[model samples]
Target: MITQEKYRTTVKELLANGTIKMAIGYRPGSTPDRRRPLFIRTSEEADQLVLDSTCITNLSGYLVTEGLLSDEKQVGIFLRPEGIRSINILAAEYQLNVDQIVIFGFDSTGREVRPLQGRNAGDFSALLTEIKENPPLTSKEPLLERVEKMNAKERFDFWQEEFSRCIKCYACRQACPMCYCRRCIVDSNQPQWINTSSHTLGNFEWNVVRAFHLSGRCVQCGNCDRACPVNIPLRLINQRMAKEVVDGFDHFAGLSPTQEPVLASFKKDDTETFIL
Candidate 1:
């Protein structure tokens, strides 16, 4: 309870101080299952912020607006594991300056915060010890086995079947905090990359483009999967892409805020079996 409250309170303080131009988070929206982005610019507004299982929309998704912020001002973010992954992608792509943002990381204790050593060590130490002792549940260790358990053909056919149910609502793209392109390829009129119709080919092309674009950059946060109105298991794409990045480039999580997004750059010795 303390950790979750810490995140909520600190965010409220920053908003009250006017330190951040705006603090974006989630509160219960118009309906029970819906949660809207709560942008708090005042202490009273900040007080309205809440954290719970219903918080799913990536706050980073709002960071990509036109005239979003003054370059001179800094932004503070409340990050879950997946939100942090979005930060990694943004940092690597050079789309946003990492130095201008502050991150607040919290671990859910299955619902509430657990007291660590009577609050003995500070949050950082407590987090470090917990992290060192027990690995993150989001780690890709379980994914590789699930992949190996299935044959190649089964895997391919599996995705085709799952993605075939797609309604092409573009919720996956909208929920993604990293997909900030002003004019998506699908919407481009110069030459349509994929038809706007909800055809299988269009859906496949859209998903393929999304996956290939995210390749090494995906953080595997599962927001896209959650956002799918049709309930597609879109995290499979994230998991597969993460596995590919690990297997192909030996690169894993983007821990450093200053590190370049890896998939955007190519090394001279990169493998290219399909090139010829």
Candidate 2:
């Protein structure tokens, strides 16, 4: 609650001084445990801001809305550490300019929400490095362990059963910050890449293609997992892919705005274990 009040005051000050044209934060939702995005452009709107442990949705995606930053005015946004990494990825891809953003970073443990001491993405370099060295325990949970221990055929069956439930709603893609493609291949008819219907085979192809696209770029924010209406374990697939890149290339996604994408760039000594 103290942190919440501090940010409200900060937003009000920034707006009063014309430091930012808008601020994106959270507000109470329909339920006690839910939160919705609040766009603050005035002092009265700043009063509606809510910052707490439940404010976990990555609000960075809203930064890419068309024409929002065309005027080049700064926009302040509430972000978690993962959200900061996302902006780095977006900047690296030329999706948005980091200079136009002012970060209000925060993270939480249990019910305690604490402010992170940084206003720009570059200011959090050391902290991001620390996170890359020691990732969160959620990445190594028992479910991922069980999937990793499965034989090839067992693993195929496992994911097949999960993919069978997909309804092709694309909620996972919509929720992901990394899926910024203006015209996704699934929607393309030029060459007709994958089956567009919601059959199990189509579902498998869609999910696989999306996972492959995010191989080395996912921040594991769990937005896709939470947004899946059918409750597919989308995080497991992305986490497995992220681990593969780190082990094979020593690459951690979103370390900086200029970091080369792991799969996009090639090196002479790149691992070729699967070449057989």
Candidate 3:
């Protein structure tokens, strides 16, 4: 297990050496067991860094925040396995430059905090490959299994019921690293692609559109899931879409920076069973 002191010492060295202009990691939250994102510019602030299972918030979303990375200086970020995948997705989609960010990778599984070796996102290719080849059993959530058992109508009804509680808060959109759009479809009032109201039809449209937008690009970080105030199973929708992309296009999202997004790429021999 990587101790807090070791993590702090490493971050301090990186800061002192001018390897990064800023470091983004976790600090203690309001509650005892909670952790929140912390941005540190000085080596002395390194002591505030902490890593644990509660450090689950994917800080990759902050990487593409407005003017956050505009200074042309290298920025360091503490990343989990999923967060690294988000970085790859961001690079592939041209949202950010992969070379400008330095990764301090760590995996906090169960109660242990393990350090990962990688200066850049591509450095952990082997580890990512291993994870893709052999996913951990714990990766499958029980809620997803239950949802799979429902019939088509039942599933639709389930989603309808869940979406009814939506208040169009847009928290899910804000929390997602892949949803870096300046103007979402629902926000477009010129043509009114989707209704912005929180009524049943509008809510359904918002949720479905959000899911489809993230269909092939989602990194399964569960940030959107946690950000929803209504406790909707947003991650399940993303996981199901990811599974379909894999089975249909043989494409996995964010595996490599060079890989094309599943939805964006088209092939001559692609399957079209759904087409009449």
Best by TM-score: 2
Q: How well is each residue in 62-108 modelled by candidate 1, as lDDT tens digits?
A: 77676665465767666665566566567666666666666665435
User: Can you rank all candidates by lDDT, best first?
Assistant: 2, 3, 1
Ranking by TM-score: 2, 3, 1
Candidate 2, lDDT over the whole model: 0.93
Q: Estimate each model's TM-score.
A: 0.80, 0.98, 0.95
Please report, as a residue range, the 10-residue window in candidate 3 with the lowest summed lDDT.
Answer: 132-141
Positional deviation of 77 in candidate 2, in angstroms?
0.8
Candidate 2 similarity to native, TM-score: 0.98
Give stretches of model 1 more than 4 Å off. Answer: 4-9, 30-34, 114-156, 271-276
Best by lDDT: 2
Q: How high a TM-score does candidate 1 get?
A: 0.80
Per-model clash counts, in order, read 2, 0, 0
